[model samples]
Structure formats: structure tokens, C-alpha cells
Target: MNSPGVKIHHLDGIKILDLFAGPGGLDVAAHFLGFKSIGIEWDRNACETRYAAGLPTIHADVSVMRESRFAEIPSTVDVLAGGPPCQSFSVAGNGKGRRALETVKKFIHRLVDGEDEARIDEDLRALDDPRTALVLEPLRWLLKAIDTEGRDPYKVIVLEQVPAALPLWEVYAKLLRGGEGRLKGVKYEAECWQLKTEQFGVPQTRTRAVLVARRPGHGAIAPLKATHFPFDLHRGKRNVAQAEMFPAEPATPGGKQRWLSMAEALESASSLENSPVDVSRLRRNGRMEFFVVSNYGSGGDPKNRGQRLSSEPAFTVTGKVSRNKVYKSMAEYEADTSERFTIHESGVLQTFPHNFPWSGNDQAQQVGNAVPPRLGMHVLSWALRGSPPSDDELVAAATWPNTPRTTTAELRDIGCGDQSQCPPGSHKVTRSRRKPAP
Candidate 1:
């Protein structure tokens, strides 16, 4: 019953301004829920992707945002949604917490206390990774929205980033508090949760530190609880809590958190026409099943890449996901031409609309960097506990513009940025519907 089309909550006409909005994942979610929104992004490819997807966009650097940025928008915005460039603070990146975080905090506290704005500018220039300072830009705008003329108290605030940035959010919650007691009465209370996308029915596993702040008047924003569970490769290999199972129709009854597996997720999109793929003789839900080909080794070699069973959630689909080998096991074992996941398959793994017009040049980076739109739906649902969208709308949003589709043939023999380092059989596809995966 918990299908993609089954909207559990409605945004209820909220206006959203998505900063650093990569490829408009939040915009897609907002549009599906009927929320009025605009996205500002610096990436040209991502902006084109947004435009092609039929979402409104302002292609500009978020750091230079002036008070007049949102002046022309007809309605007052209800939510301030942002995900600043997180690379500088990502644990995966070498720049994690390299003194810039402390500087960022100092800037945030000062800005919250209404200090000399010029000093903050000076500190930004001195930071290690100036990109990290972009995180503070939201606070700058929040301060302006509150102190300057003609702005209303933002009804909600939503933000996300790597887990390393949790401390920044904690400070943000304090600043967001309406005086002191959020339990009693507050304009908004901010809280962050470490969320796993796999737990939200995404075939791939991705964790994001999420923040949601909501003002008084409506019910408190509910903490996002996982709606699905991590699927097990070997059914009896591990005993997981019933709560961790994905709830299915009949097969697994009683609220089991049956996580979607990669095979099931991509089954509809599988095609072995031009490329060689050894489809396993196994069958699930009336379709041929094939094990994923991967470089992952169970021996725990940190240097070597790892693999995930088609029956289990995928590893984090990075910008290099295409380069991650996805093979058809050779019969009971398979692998001649190393199979690669098409852009559409990779995008769907991130829970973007299956046919989302990825109208950009760097398709891999666009899909990898994007906020999974399904994750967006889950987060917003928790933030707005209201009427859900009609199943039709959800389906529409997931499959809209049905063009520039990626196909099995196109993904064959693609090339990565550095062709020499590109994965075997590397293939590339342009954004939009020249081909389709599903």
C-alpha cells in the first residue's frame, strides 16, 4: 500500500526556495505535492536539467544572493530549503572539518546575534574551503528575512548535508528556537536526523543528515521514521527486526519493512539486446533475475570497490556509479562484456523519476549529486502532515516528460571524464528521451 504514488502528506501550497538546488530534486518533490517553488543553482548542467524537467530555476551562485533575490516572487515563501555545497565537509572528501567548520560556526553565531556583517565577509575569505561558507548563507538570508522589512516568519526550514555538518545544524536549532521552550510555543524548532534512503524504499543505500524546522500554529513536525527496511540477500542469513521490513501486499504480511532490492528496482528496465548480459535463470515477480556484477570484495579490502547483491540494497551510488561495474553473473556465473548501469538505472536507483529528463552534459554528476526525489517526498511528508497527493499525481511526477530516455545500447561502451580511467565498456547518454531505461 505504501507505493510511490501514495502520497502520505501534502505540502498545501507552500512556497519553497531551494538553494544549491542540484538538478531540482526538491523541486520535483515540491511540484508533485503542488507546492509553489523556485530553485537557485550554480551548475549549468544541473540548471539545464531543471529547465528540461519543467521546473523554475535561477542559475546563480548562492553566496552572492542579495536581499532582492526573491523580491519578484509573487508570494511569501513558506520554507527555506538549502543544501549548500557539502563536499568541503564530507567525510568522504579530504577537506572534512579542516578548521573551516569552526569558522563557519563563529560566523553563524555572530550573524544570529546581528554582528557586523562586514566581519563575517572577512572570515569567509579566510576559511579553508570557501565553499563550506556557503552553508552560512542560509543564516544570512534567515537573518535578513527576520530583521529586514517586508518578510514574514518562515513557516518552516529544511536543510541537509553530510553527517559531519550535524554540529552546524545543532547550532541552527538553537537559533531557530522561538525563545526557549519548543515543547510549549515556538515559531519553529529545528531537529536533524541521520536518514538512510534505503530505509525509505530506495534500492540504493544513501545516508543524509536531514534538518526540519517548523513554526507554531500547525502540529509539530514529526521526526522522519523509515517506512521500509533493508532487504536481506539470503533470507535466513540474518534476523532483522520486523520493523525493518518493507510492508508488502500479501507475501510478507503485518507491516514488514521489505526494502526494495536492486534487481527488483531495475528488473523493469533490464535489456540485453546489444550488450551481453547473462540473465540468471531465477525468477521473481514473474521476471528473469540476474546477480549484479561488482568489484566489491567481502574480504574487507578498503582499497577495492565492493558489490551489492541484486537482492540487497545497492552501495551508495556516487558520481562514479556508472564506473561501478554492474555485471550479469556468468550463468550461475556470468561476465564477458562488463555490464554498466545506464543513466536512467542509476537515476532510478537514486529514486529520481524513472524518465526524468536529465537534460545536462555531465549526466553522471547530475544524478550522483542530486537529492533523491523520493527522499524529498519522505522528508517533506514528515514536515507537512497533511493530505497526501492522489496516486495519479505521484505516478505522473515519477514518469513525467518521458523523454531523453537512456537505453541499454547507449550505456554500452561509454566513457568517463578521463577516458583512459573510464570503466570497461563505458557508455554515455545525453539527457532527455532519445532513449529510456524502463
Candidate 2:
């Protein structure tokens, strides 16, 4: 699996720079994999959470990080990673970016042609959501590494975003592969895939579009293999092809686990004594099962609210996660709202450590925007090691830091910054990337 000039080093020697890092989800995974990591995030709320988790961070905007020839960037960066703001392209938001796909592609080609920054910025400002143009920032950084006189090109690149961004990722894969336009003979092996969170053992049912690329001479790479079945597949509701492709039970010979459930994740053992939540109240009709009643509508109909069972993964956690109600059964839901998931419980569903300190004003947004750390571990292992982490490693990463829980109030007391000072578009977070049902 070794490649010329791209040999895998001891994990300790690898270094990574994460742009738009939202509360260190990938940074936490990089730590578990023994890679040194530093994240640059403009969001103060996320920065506070990172500090509480003991992750290194550079509190600055990604747009500003490219100044002075990337002067503040570490010289030994081996991996380039980021998740740009996705609201413009998300179905949950207005489809400004999606509508402007052709325009974004033109900008990408302009980057390849060495267009000046001012011209590009001026054109980008014309868009409905300028944040949509931020998706190209990773490519800007990547291209700079190759063009700058003294810098060595990054060996690997990984990016994640809402599924609607997959078309954009496909465009990136082409540019990295190299051909007629500007990246002639680059020969990097690159691929993009839409992956479900639950398939990687996350307790939430969400999907993300991911792109992984290796420099020239690195061996070809493929999408990360799923270690668990999806919610529908585990319930035997999927078609024959998917069923045959993945094992049915955790006990099956292939060793694939069934989809992780909300109850299992929230109730799992953790290093912090206060972390293991007592979900007995969620038991339906005295049975050991629970349900989640979403605050949002199903298919845009307010009367048709969405719901999921405890045996299955929870619905995609949103910035409004605290608004969702958990009930013992349909009867309880119809009678009245039972209880809401606490901030800590909400983080648990996202596969964040139980004790992770949630900080700043909008704590719910902080947790919702994070890349699921468990899923991060799998993806990072695939990019750097060309394989998946062992079951033992995954288990160990889940309990990362092994520290006591840091309360949200405590984080605020320590200068997390005034909520009013954060600008309107400063925060960057992804929304649901799953496909719309027929």
C-alpha cells in the first residue's frame, strides 16, 4: 500500500490542518489516530468547545488564513481537510448555491487558470449566498501548496459537506486527477462518496458527501467501507441487493454490527460518571423501547411530524435539537410532550464524547454542526492508513480525553466571547444531506 514520496509515516509524525473546524470532530479523531492537528474556526462558540476538549485551535476565519502566503500555516502539513459552509446548497435552506452550480464551476476553472483574488471575490459577492463560494477555499489552499516556492504539496486531502455538495466534490476529483485545463499530469488518486452516518456507527441518521484524495504516486483510494448496517437495512426493509451486500445481524459471520440506536449510545458507559444517561423514562408502554418526536414537519407538512423508534437511529440532529421531544410511545406523544433531550444527550446522539464541554451562546448549533467523531475516525483511518480502525481502537476513541464533563455555564464564564459580537454569517455548519423521499 506504500507509494513513492507518499509512504505512510508513523502516526505520530503526521500533521493536519483542519479549516472551518466546528468543535474539533475531525481533530478529535486525528488525536485518536495519533496525528498532530490544529483547527482554524471563525466561530467563537466552537472555539470555546475545542479549548474545553483540549484541542489546539487557531481562532480565525478561513478566508483570512491564506494571507502572507499562508504565513501562519505549519510547514509540516501532510493532510488538508475541511467542511465548508453548506447552508446555501442544503435543501433545508434556500437553494441559492444549488441554483448557482454552473457559476461555481466557472469560478473553479478560474482558480485553475490563476485568476486574481479581487476579481473572484467581486464575482462571488454577486451570488445570493457568498458563503457558497467558500467551498472553493480548500482548493485555493491546496493549489497554493503546489505553487508556492518552498512548500511541499499536501500528501492527502479530505473534505465533507452536505450531500447536495456531491456534484461540487465530483468537480474537485476531476481537477485533482489532472488533464487539459490547468492540472495536467497531476496523477492524484481521488474519489467522492455519499455516506450515511449510522453505517459508521453514529446514533443519528444523517448523510454527508465526502471527498478523499492522495498526491501523485499514492496508490488508488476507494470509499470507506461501512462497519454497520443502516437503519432500514437492519430492519429488513431494504431491497435485495443491499441486503446481500451487507450482513443482517451483528452476530453474523462477517462481524458487521447492526445500526446503533439512540438509547444504546445515550446509555453507554463513559469515563465521566455523569455521562451515562438514565433513559428508562423513554420506555414505551413499560417496554424497553423509546421514540423521538421531531419538532419539524415531514415532507414540509406541519401536521405530519417525523418520528423514529429507539431501536433505530435518531433523525438528523439539527441546531434546534433541544426543541425535539422524546416520548415513551405514540400515545404519550399524542397526549403531551414527554421530555426533551438535554444538551449532553443531544451531543451523545451525534457521537460526541459524553463529557464534551458545550460552550458559547448557541450550544445546540455547536453540537449539530459537528462532524460525527466516530464517523471521522473511520474516514481518517481510510485516508491515511488505507484501512479501517480496529474495533478496539474505535471503542477507545469513543471515550476520548477520559476527563470529567465541563458544564456549558463553566465554559461561558471563561471568556467564550459576547454572543452579540459574532457576525451574522461567521458561523459555518452543515445541514441534512440525505436524499428526499419519493
Best by TM-score: 2
Best by lDDT: 2
Candidate 1 TM-score over all chains jointly: 0.75
Candidate 2, residues 1-438: lDDT per residue as tens digits? 222222222222438999899888898888888788877787877887776776656667787767542755667787999889888988777889999988898899898877787898888899988889899999888777776779877888999999999988999998888733444345478999999999999988899999999876657897688988766634355333232454446675656677777767876733346665556566565654766778654665646777677666788888889878777766777788688888878888988877776766789988888888888888989999988977778777656464333422332322223333233555546687999899
Question: Per-residue lDDT for 301 in model 2?
Answer: 63
Every candidate's CA RMSD: 10.6, 9.7
Candidate 1 C-alpha lDDT tens digits along 18-64: 88889877888877776767777777678667766656555555654
- lDDT of model 1, residue 255: 47
Alpha-carbon local distance difference test for all models: 0.64, 0.76
Per-model TM-score on C-alpha atoms: 0.75, 0.83
